[model samples]
Target: MPFWLSWAVWSAPVKKLGARPAISSGCSGVTMLNWLTAQHLVGLPGMPTTVQGVNARAKREGWEAQLRLGRGGGQEYSFAVLPKETQTALLMREVAQQEPAPAQQLQQPGAAQVVNSPKRDAYTESRLNDDQRSVMAARMVLIREIERMSKVVSQQRAIDTLVGLARTGSLSPYLAERAERANDRKNADRALSERTLKRWLADYRKHGEIALAPARRKPNMSVPVWAADFLKHYQRPQKPSAQAAYLAFQREYPGAPSLHAVQRFLAKLSPQAREMGRMGPREAKALLPYNKRLTDHMWPNDVWVADGHKFDAEVINPNSGQIFRPEVTSIIDWATRRIVGFAINVAESTLATLDALHSGISRVGMFRVFYVDNGSGFANDTIREVVERLGGEMTHSLPYNSQARGVIERAHRTIMVRLAKDFDSYIGADMDGEAGNKVHRISRADLKKGSQPRHIPTLNEFYERLAIALDEYNHSPHRGLTKIRDSETGRFRHPSPMEAWRRAEAEGFAALQPSTELSMLLVRPQDLRRTHRGLVRTNGANYFLQDLVPLHGDQVRVAWDYRDASKVAVFTLDGDLIGQAILDGNASDAMPRIVKDQDRRVSGQLAKLVQKGKTLTGKDVELRVIERPAEDDRFQQHLLEAEKFVALAHEPEADALEAPDNEMTRYDRWQQLDSRQRLGEALSDDEARWHASYPNHPDFKSIQRMYDHFEAEQARA
Candidate 1:
């Protein structure tokens, strides 16, 4: 047979080579001619002489490429893809014959014994899947020829070629041209276009061809002062028409530039004009062509993904005086399709993601893989340690590649849709504290008026309710599960997650890793700090124990600074708010500062309104106030009334304070008070305290807080 004929016969889909080819191993003395030819055919650093030799090399070097069973086992495909160098190596050694080192090869015509091109690094065999590499190689040739002619082509010809290539289904003409330059001529055989060719040269001129790594365009661009001003002033909605921008520009600069001149300026803003596009934080565009690890075969438990998303809800933020969005985090078991843990909060960021992960690991033991999107919060090594310590692999998806985490992404969608549709009711409401429960209750008429947009108390309230809603979801059954009974034990195979989890405890599934840091979270800051002799801090302010400077050097994280600020909180970085540092400031007068003066003036109006209400006795305002460490006269009076209430719930005196037929007198009182006060009038301490504190339940904390406030007011007076 002709050498080419024999080669054709040898090249037919040779099953004997197996699915995962082993072209990158072994150096057992090949004959000079075979070695040189192999080098030329594969151009790879390590090419085996025979099939057995290849397998032996692969086994010895563990370079066997992974082969995966395709969907429905339709085909066997390579799982392990390699870098470009390896692919080049494979083409040179396996596809081409070396023949003799050209007559031009002798000692590089007398240069120091030619280095032989570094012997093509041992990993030179093709790294891309075989089929893809062949296609890519063929495509490269087309790109080279296309670009070769494009540089000299006219503008109109370039445009026609660009359109032609797109019409012909070329994978990014720019990229094809790039691949052509990197690979040998034989590989550059794809269809070509003048537009693509010109673009390649233009890019080479601006950003060297090598810099155009197979990646997406970056989104970050430093906006020029003029552009920033343009964005702010550009009146026409999105991507303004040229005529509109030119007109607007003429108006802004008035004779500074004409429409024709501005249009010329705009022509400079064309996609090909700028070396880099406009900046949009660029975080999302940095990943292009995708990383091998990102696109590589990902099995469940290979990574754990974490992220926080805002859930639309009926929420009111009392502080901001407006409804704000609430956020929630979910830890999903990628393989089992289970939501392992969740945490909800007002802000969805790094700290919140940490809190959610904190809740997850504490509840579900540990996961093997942690995956999250490339958001600021999920990008921290501090947060990543949670996974690392748990022996879990951590990874962030390429920006916008939510599909990479198909399992959890689907779960997020499933839960969000289900919750939005079947959302029951918020668990609790401020109807129980701030203004006396005057929160407009959804009446029968309001309920009947479908989607009337009833008011929500606050973002905090919404989060609490979402927490409950998510819990219900975890306990819900799925159609995918099958009920099975063990042949011997007769236990059902599929149980609700909660039920299965409970049973797992009985079967030794609960083994807590007693890391000191993890265990410390159980201790509250109030008790733990005194025990540990540690100082405390909260909200960026630090507190030192009266006699505890000995421990000042030690650091801790502050957790719960109580609503009253009575005790400062401190914690270790690992989420353990285990101790408190009590405040021991003087009992004397405080020197008011400029900021405090402004604060007092700002609060003066709220005070005047609170005092406008009818003077109700402490008994009339039912509120829970935290017991102050030290006794105050007002606190004592309120404490006595609360004690009497608990003692007199069934007593006739309690009924005397109630409205006729058990109507809430306090609610009616608030309505009367609000009617008398203008929307923004100032009120006295007694009134302002009640005004702000009434919406929360009238518990001891609210009342004692009021009493403490009145005590401070009296002292100030």
Candidate 2:
């Protein structure tokens, strides 16, 4: 089914003190400007933040602003305030100008600032007295103690335990409650069911228990009554201290209370420090540090980066008639200023991304650093090892900060708009054959063919065509290079992208993939899982060819979407195609070897469907032979159908019309086929008309698309 899409909005709040206002986000800079101005109007003492701060915060949280239900039943839109700092994003929009507001009350020089509202001060003073403050501090200690029970949770008992222990510390019940509320809100927002959430909570809270009130009965431990009573009292307000315990004993006609009594009471508790993944930086504290360190892209292999954007593949594959969707990947040689290597794949993912790096390295040597966006694709180890093995570093563009890796960012657009515009039509549509019979198409009989074709090309035929296309792309001379070579000179002036790679190789540049013509495919990193041996496993099977075991559990990077068998095939890092390990398990996925079996299935399916269609026409056409689909089935059905109709009046065939046609008409005959094949197949009427319009027409993608459109319209009626 075709997926539906829509637009949404973002917004943020602004604060003002003096003439300076809080930076705003969402609809306009006015919100930011108004916020900043408002802050100035309030004459606040804190340092005034620039538009940059507002944008960063907005982007971090999702543009602050308004959310509203949109037009459709499923449509929920959020109109967020643009990060006030995103100049280009905001300036592009046409929002109303800011209205005049009050003048500023700038801060006085060298003065201490009390950054709090009078209302805030009064409320705090009234709500929390000296005793409450002391209790609050103790409460913090108790909470920490409860948290120590380990599977940490901020429950009341946990709070009381920590409060009882700390004596006094950074304990704020308000903040604690807020944090808990936020956690609950997040889960709520996630839309998980209550029972599921409770299950998760129970699992998380496995450490110690929390109680809403104090224990009714004290534990019957073998300790002195006076000492135990002292311990319990100390946890409560106005409870007895060590001195008071001794005084009480004396008053009751007793004498000896040892120092060991107090020491033993305090020694009952111990704490554990937090654990971490990498000893270097905690995930919470992990961030791009700003130390004013300047990077000039000064050295080779400094950074290998990646990013994603919607490419106008339509324009890129202009002549193509197949349903086209392509997201390209390109790696750049930072030091030499060249687009070292690239690949055009179906989606933005790590699976289809690894090959691009291999291409760059194989072509240019090794880039120092690999830079990429903070996306799941690059998060995999495939990218990490590729960069490290090349003796390069891997860095990432800050989230929403494209300027960090500006070089390759522009390179992608340059190739798409400047170099690739010529191939768009044929990339998605059938470009080769004269608009008819020889054209790649989906026929009515394809309904019974089974799977949706990735590109509708036989592997044997595609491998040949792919080689030619690669050669054409690599050798092309154009503006991206300093030298634009023509047929007249047939010479090199400045180096093109490919030529530059060749030059770099001469100077000791090493690439991952040595032979670009090996005919490879890209798979998203998601399909793969890392095994203990470091080999990448996918398709519910292990990839253990001898060449792969060395890297064992390492992920195999790909440069294209190979999810569909037609466009997808696995290869070794050493660059061997059509090879795999024998496996023993419940791996249900059919291997490419099953290609023959699948073909036979398609052929049998097509012959059966043709028979069914003939039944609709009320004729018993002689069944000549059932052909396998992979070999070629489109033309066979048309031939069979046409011949079957001819037999409708013939002597022996005339008796075949006795089969009932009240229900299964030739059109409904398509309903018997599988969805994938039906998607490519044309309706019987269109198929008949197409044959009449151009008996020898070859390409079928366009004709099938038209028939699908008509079928949809008929459905509406």
Candidate 3:
């Protein structure tokens, strides 16, 4: 038998039995060259025997499986058994080669007409660069290309081609070059393995192009549940560290994320969120952008910023001769950066703020806006009313945001703090030492020790110095002010507050002339009572006004100048100005001089009486009574006679005096005898004669009896 026939016989059983070809245990697969050699078909002259030589020849000859099994390092691949039909076809083709074809058959018309598979058009490149395109978008493009190829070729064939390309790392020339540059040899050689291609194909079959992109890692919802509790514990004023918070989180959630994870999450938080845990809300809020308001285009009196700063230096109280720190209230013109007005008091009060505002408006003009902090003195209804009445609005800075009142705050630092440094009693924020040192600096011990009579200036002297300093400040060139040409000199110069005011006036932004009446409206009114004597009392002083005389016994509104108690403006309930009252005298005395003098004299007399040990008794009372004149004797006798006459007139009529029946004549004769005995003056002549004639007459007696009977009957009825 021929060697080919023997090789064919040896491979026939493996093909028929449907079993893998027998090979060495170390090498389960055979290369195309090795299989061809085993068949004893290698005797052709100049035919290469190596796998590389075979692969080159197979590639040129368009043999797919043979070329794939014969490429570089392909000799180690598992052998792919040919099908029985394929084996029979190979044998038949070999037999045909042995027998020459007839000329007629070879020359048959159109006998070699080629049948070619459909060729797909090359995929159009994407306009987006690799970096610009998302990984998922690129994958989608690739999936679309694969699907398009599947329409022209078999689905399995297309998938196998893609797998082969991926395994051989020949998907794209650019991608291969990029992999080479990155020195990723494994990835460059095998960009996507067969397993990866199969996974992608399976995904594409199931979910279309979306499946070509890598699946996202599922979000750990469980981690968020623990993280939420962690954040709640972490973001606090106490400001626990991430590790501390993680430990705390375990208490709330048994299975929390690790501390490292918590730290990474915290690091990803916003600046404000991170700051909020360490600092409080107020401080954290400061991290946000603020709307910076500028007053560049504003006129000199457009906005006035006001604030009260406690003076850092001690000054002697003139009245008490004691050293004390005073509070200074200052108002600054926002546009000009000028301290328009200021006031100093032993302490900050609404009165101090009012006075400062009043002075500012009086000197610089009415402002359009009053910017202030939420201080008790500046948040006053009186101050608000003052600003509103002046055709301005009052705006309060947000709590804890002092920057809103920057103008006045800066003024407090620039003017007051600078001035304070000149005094030995300076105790400002930047002062060197603690509270005790500051207290010792202002202590009265030095004065008690007769150390040069203590050098602290009196309040009045300090006020004078402050006034001079303010004048200098108003004239000094202001940094915030812009340069302006002097009208008189026609030369450019940096504008001071005074210069700014002058320039504003020249430019027709003249200030509104202050009205004293409007200013008085801002003065705080005190409900006070006026005495019937036309006196009003306040602040331990009695005030009197001629206009208040008629207003006595009425409740009046008294508004006084805080700086001076000499006079106060009094108004009625209806806001009618009654009159100004002058400080008359101390309210402690509260009495007319004459009355007070009398009381003093009475007190002195009582003191003298007590010194003499004099006491009142019955003998003293009898002596005092004996000093009076006695009553008249005649008057006593008249009183006794009148008493007896009154007793006789009231005596009841006796029953024996009444005579019955015809006893009328006897009664009439008795009446005549009683009348003659009682008569003080004699009757007229006619009366006397008639009485004598009818004295004992029976007719007279009968008439008298009838009258008596009529009287008795009338009385009974």
Candidate 4:
């Protein structure tokens, strides 16, 4: 019989009894043969030919039930009829059984649909310890194994196998091998005891796969106040040790946990928390994940990093003949890791930084960004302006964060620090203390003796060696660079910094050309006064040119190299460069004319004093002779005779001077008379008094010659 037709006729709720009805209680019921006939009456195939076949089919379908005849000698048998709702449910169940499996359904067209479960309002899983998470992971493996096994065998059979394994305290061969490979005991358990399995099954039915995870123990809520206080104090930069914190805690609160407990607590803390407690905030911050700056698409000259490193080795200063550590300011290309420029200075200063930046820009062309640390040399207005003028933006790393400028910092270690190791005077951070001190002492003694130390190289020699090292570094293979074939060698090799730079340039990453005015922008500026002589004096040297005369006495901007003050670039207050000025070596050598005139006046005053002394001495001798009574009359007679002789001598010269015949002579005679009168009057003063005391002085003839020459000049006029 067809399965559906037989099922409908036999399982129908209503049934009719047979005609022989008085022997047994005949409630309306159908026998197996009658049910079969009913199936044929419905135009379907009759039931199985034998009665046994009909009864076997009904029992297999779970529709057979035994019922007793009421008050009868024996019981009658009939199939229990299903209700209408039961029939419909069974029909639906049969239809579902014929449907394809879930995996098979996914392979069919239009079978994919989003299935959304109710969103959880609270956390689905709490934080788990490492051990708990590991245990949960192992249990999850077992659950997946069961699920996979159920596809090939009955679920009951799979459960029975797992239960048998758990009773014998053994695991599946696959799980045992995995546990041995992993060296984890927890993963070796792939089965559960019957009781445990039953509990797991109940949990799975309630909460799905999540219930397979191990439950965590409740956290201790009654933490002592002292423990909290200790944690707070321990994480400080001073970083008290756990024992020290525990000791302190005991003093503050006697009810705190024991030292062993505290130690255990610390051991279980998160790595970041432990680092914070023992190391410092800086170390703790390092534990956190940070976004890495990506430069994959960056080209050479896109960014440049600059920093100043105090060279570890002492070098001789050429100008001063002294040994000192020099600061090396360097600029590196971000993409190629190549050193583009560097400069050495006695200290880290704006001029030094500018020199490095200028060298880089001039050699490689302009860049787009300039990265630097927040150093006084780099964070100034001048550097900022110079960077902007070079068509780049200047960015400063966070304070005390050298990692941000790590390219140049690492370059210092890789190049300069390594170079310093070859020198005996290296005072590197890792140098042995006694040796460094001894070397330093010897160098100091040499300086005191006015001699150069053999251990140190001169500045020029240092620069020469540094250049070699830098060249080697730039051409060396770098891990950051991509591998490429060498064009000349025709062999595979890692790309060098210079090779990378060339490639970038060829690929349209060409650098911008800098202007001629770019260098002037990098120099240090000073407000200086220009002398009236067109000279500007700085550092005891006068810088000037003929063109600067117009700016004399005006306060103008003077830009010059601090290390070389022999020349300066002169600029107006409005930033116009007038001209360059050379040092005037003799600017301070010349004296003013007024000083010479003062020297002449002082010499004349000394001469007059000497003449006055002589006059006074002669007068004293004459007075002594006149004071003697015996010689008084004789002296008087002698003075009168001398006066008469002087008068006669003067009369003839005066008459000769007055003698004039023509108009010019008449004028000369008048001038001679006027000069004689004026001369007589001048002789009555101090000069004449000194001369009159010594009338026979040798200077008298020269004086008379001076007056005669004056008369002759007047006669000609």
lDDT of 3 by residue, 116-191 (tens): 1011111111222343235545545555556788899976677677657755777687544432332212232525
Candidate achieving higher TM-score, 1 or 3: 3
TM-scores of all models? 0.35, 0.30, 0.47, 0.56
Candidate 2 residue runs with Cα over 4 Å from true position:
1-305, 308-324, 343-345, 380-382, 417-495, 498-538, 542-580, 583-717
- lDDT (Cα, 0-100) at 388 in candidate 1: 65
lDDT of 4 at 59: 50
Which regions in candidate 4 have their CA more than 4 angstroms from the true location?
1-193, 197-224, 271-284, 481-494, 521-526, 549-551, 574-577, 585-717
Please state every model's RMSD to the true fold in angstroms. 24.2, 31.6, 43.2, 35.2
Tens digits of per-residue lDDT for model 1 on 417-445?
55543333222332234432333355223
Write model 2 residue lDDT over 499-548, tens digit each, in one string. Answer: 55565567675544323232123212324334345233455444334444
> What stretches of model 1 exceed 4 Å from their correct place?
1-304, 389-393, 421-454, 479-495, 499-508, 513-544, 549-579, 582-717
Candidate 3: regions farther than 4 A off: 1-226, 240-262, 321-323, 434-457, 476-495, 517-527, 546-551, 571-580, 585-717
Find the 10 residues in a row with the least total lDDT in model 1. 108-117
TM-score, prediction 3: 0.47
lDDT score, residue 235, model 3? 71
Of candidate 2, the 10-residue stretch with the lowest lDDT total is 3-12
Give me the candidate number with maximum TM-score.
4
